[model samples]
Target chain A: MRLTTLQKFLWAAVAVALVAVGAVFLLVDRSPEPIAQAAFRPTFSLPDAGGRLRTPADFEGKHLLVFFGFTNCPDICPTTLAEVAQVMDDLGDQAGKVQPLFISIDPERDREMGLAEYTEAFHPSILGLAGDAAQTRAAADSFRIYYEREANLEALDVYAMSHSPGLYLISPEGDWLGQFTYGTPASEIVADLQARL
Target chain B: MKRIFATLALIAAAGPALACETVTVGPLEVSQAWSRASIGTARPGVVYLTIRNSGTADDALMSITTPAADMPMLHQTVMTDGVASMPHAMEVPVPAEGQVALEPGGYHAMLMELTQVLEEGETFPVTLTFRDAGKVTIPVTIQNIGASEPTCPSPDE
Candidate 1:
């Protein structure tokens, strides 16, 4: 059916309104605001391999891939560290711009030297850090990392720890960029790092 | 007779392709036996492998014994709510004509109180006892500390 001039004008106005709404939605979705930067830098002054206190500020110019795990952990900790090592390997020269930190939640057992041995096994550049009970708790709280000793702790050497497996990607400027869930591929991590860099 | 000979020849030609670094005992083929390098002598290490049963009957892995570890125990890593924990497992079941992969972040043997530090490129022997298949000795290769998956040379090569 042929439309009257008034009806045609009304349809054109509705089409223009739809296009304007679509453009506004797209603009809002693609806003230039940075994506979820941490309000403040989560700082920690944990002991390094040499029993010397070190802080995130020490690596001021490099991005930090921080993970919380105990050296005694047989499975998950090593798996994640392996993924980080692979990511660094895949990064090639860009690896120099990133530092992987493994913070031990089991400070009683994982000493500074032991932490050194553990982290060095994964990669020479990976740094192992540990702190006393209070320090460890504070660090975990700062990062919102959930960890607890197994309730039914067996004999001294046979106990297990239940810990969060998320890896925090902190920017060089000390802002939390994002968190990577467990089992994220190394290639994706490399891409994320490269994009951020 | 000629057709039967040709079939036999075909099977022989395909044999190497199916062969890997595996130990065959009874109907079970165990392959990719490996463990990660450890930092110290006392720290625990984990051993992983893939078990494939070809027979019509089910089998159960009873125990694992290795000199590298003072107390080798079968353990399975269970993840709940993004938290990982390990619990002792009595035995791992292998279904008939099915496979069970004892991999990282999954079922594995935890070597508690390691006698010696496991180093890369070193090999040790692990004897696995099965309920139906008796026992089989498999060489466990110590891989790099950051190795997450097993690497086997191509059988064709």
Candidate 2:
């Protein structure tokens, strides 16, 4: 059946409205500053694997990829470190300008368990950092990351830690850039970093 | 009969891909049991699987025992406002004629004080005790450290 002129005009208007909605979604997807802008400038002076004190100032001219997790974490921690390894591998030579750090929230246990070996298993480029309880709390507070150690009632001497699940990106100038939520694919993270780099 | 035996032998020999075979226990079917490679030997391990109950009565998973870890128990990863916490679950209910999936980011079997490091492409056995179904042992495949899903091979060979 042939459409009337009025019906045709309505269809055209609907098409335009759909296109407008699509454009809005695209705009929202491109800008990730809603949470990043709200975050404060992150600062921390933690000890690295080699027992040397390192801070954001130490990496004067490189982006920082920081993640906070404990060595004892089974599921999420290793998955994230693997993704960080993928990010570093995909970065190629540009990896030289990026520093990936695995900061231990369970400093006491992680220090004894050897956080260096844990991070090294994922990627050699990633550095493992562990500090005392007070230092770890300060670092987590600076980044607005929350972590709590809960005792496992079923098993004595065993515990689990609950923490914020995400990877933080900091600027070369030590500014809080943004974060990639848990399970964000390595390719998407690479694209975001590529644009910034 | 010969073909069936050959297939079973092939599955046992081909460890990783053929792991997580569906096994029936009473009125419940368990399948897709898998875990990820552990980072450190001292770090705990985890196992995920699915349970489909086909009976008229609901069944619950009571406990799990594995030689790979000294302490094996059921736990759920509860995410509240972006923070993730794991609380021990005494029993995981499997509703009658319904399914329960113990997967990543949800209910799973936690292996505390791992006796052996879980390496990628390796398989370990764990015996799950159900309230009504009694107990059944199943092999759990260890996938890549970042694997989020079980890697089960197709049966059409």
Candidate 3:
């Protein structure tokens, strides 16, 4: 195994050249964006409306489509879920690659059965989730969601909440990718998912 | 647009040319009254907008006026017993320095008992009545539903 000084220098030169070439490739990497590469995926292990713990890990290896809205939300929530179902239908075989999840910010009202019923109301694939105030707040904070209950001082029974309506796309690695708007056509979502897949 | 705003300011400052009191409300500034154009022989349509208070005083919106509708009340959409439902409302208020968003789903001016139809791309007039600001009219523009959910006016804005 003994080597001359010339042989040692030659080996050292070859190693250095390899390292230089690797660095150049790294610098010039213009590859497609990695799927859902969030530094820290804003995820939650919250309870379903039925009060059972639900975690984002349950939907790993698939795109987790998430939204923060209340069941009582008249305009946005229902319409958004409908659009999500439409997107799921559009995916066809690729649809299996993405799982739709509906997380309710109003855990107080979104009971487990209620959440299940709501999710089932749109499509069998959608999983409706809800949690107590703490868990709900944590989930929203993770996703940078803003929601508040609008209490009427005079009409206490008649109150509403304001919330964000963007659907998040989580990769199999749990990174948060950009989302589709509530009204984005289902065909567009399928196209984006297909490109990523 | 500049002329309209200028005329409104002059009327507000002068305090005499205006038929209604040129007063400030919560987050909503009152300029003039306006509503959507009702297509003749068509059914009534919904109208919505933001009511911002121009002063520090808190205010409550009392009513919305439209001649095209038989009744224009506050309406909200709710999920009850797993069913999607839209219900009527009596009032939506404007908090001090805060605003009343008349967006779809949560709080909206219901165009009930339509005397005429309101087609898309048509502008109309709506008189927003405030306890403090009196009656101010604003134009109602209709866009696709669910467009407001993602882009509600921000709090700092």
**Which model scores highest in lDDT?**
2
lDDT of 3 by residue, A1-197 (tens): 22244234434433443344444345435554453554758888787655678787877788888877765443556568767876776677888888888888777656732667667756678887787789889998787555555332113222245455778888888878886754566668778888997
TM-score per model (chain B): 0.83, 0.85, 0.61
- RMSD of every candidate to native, in Å, equals 18.5, 15.1, 22.3
Ten consecutive residues with minimal summed lDDT in candidate 3 chain A? A150-159
How badly does each model clash, as a count of residue pairs? 0, 0, 31
**Candidate 3: segments with Cα more than 4 A from true spot:** A1-38, A152-155, B1-157
In angstroms, how far off is B22's CA in candidate 3?
38
Per-candidate DockQ versus the true complex?
Answer: 0.24, 0.20, 0.05
TM-score, cand. 2: 0.78
CAPRI tier for the interface of model 1: acceptable
Model 3: residue B81 alpha-carbon error in angstroms: 32
lDDT of 2 by residue, A77-177 (tens): 87788788888988888999899988899887888888887888778889999988888999998887767654322234444566777899998988888
TM-score of chain A of each: 0.78, 0.79, 0.75
Candidate 2 versus truth, CA RMSD in Å, comes to 15.1
Model 3 TM-score on a 0 to 1 scale: 0.49
Going through the candidates in order, what fraction of the true interface contacts does each contain?
0.62, 0.49, 0.07
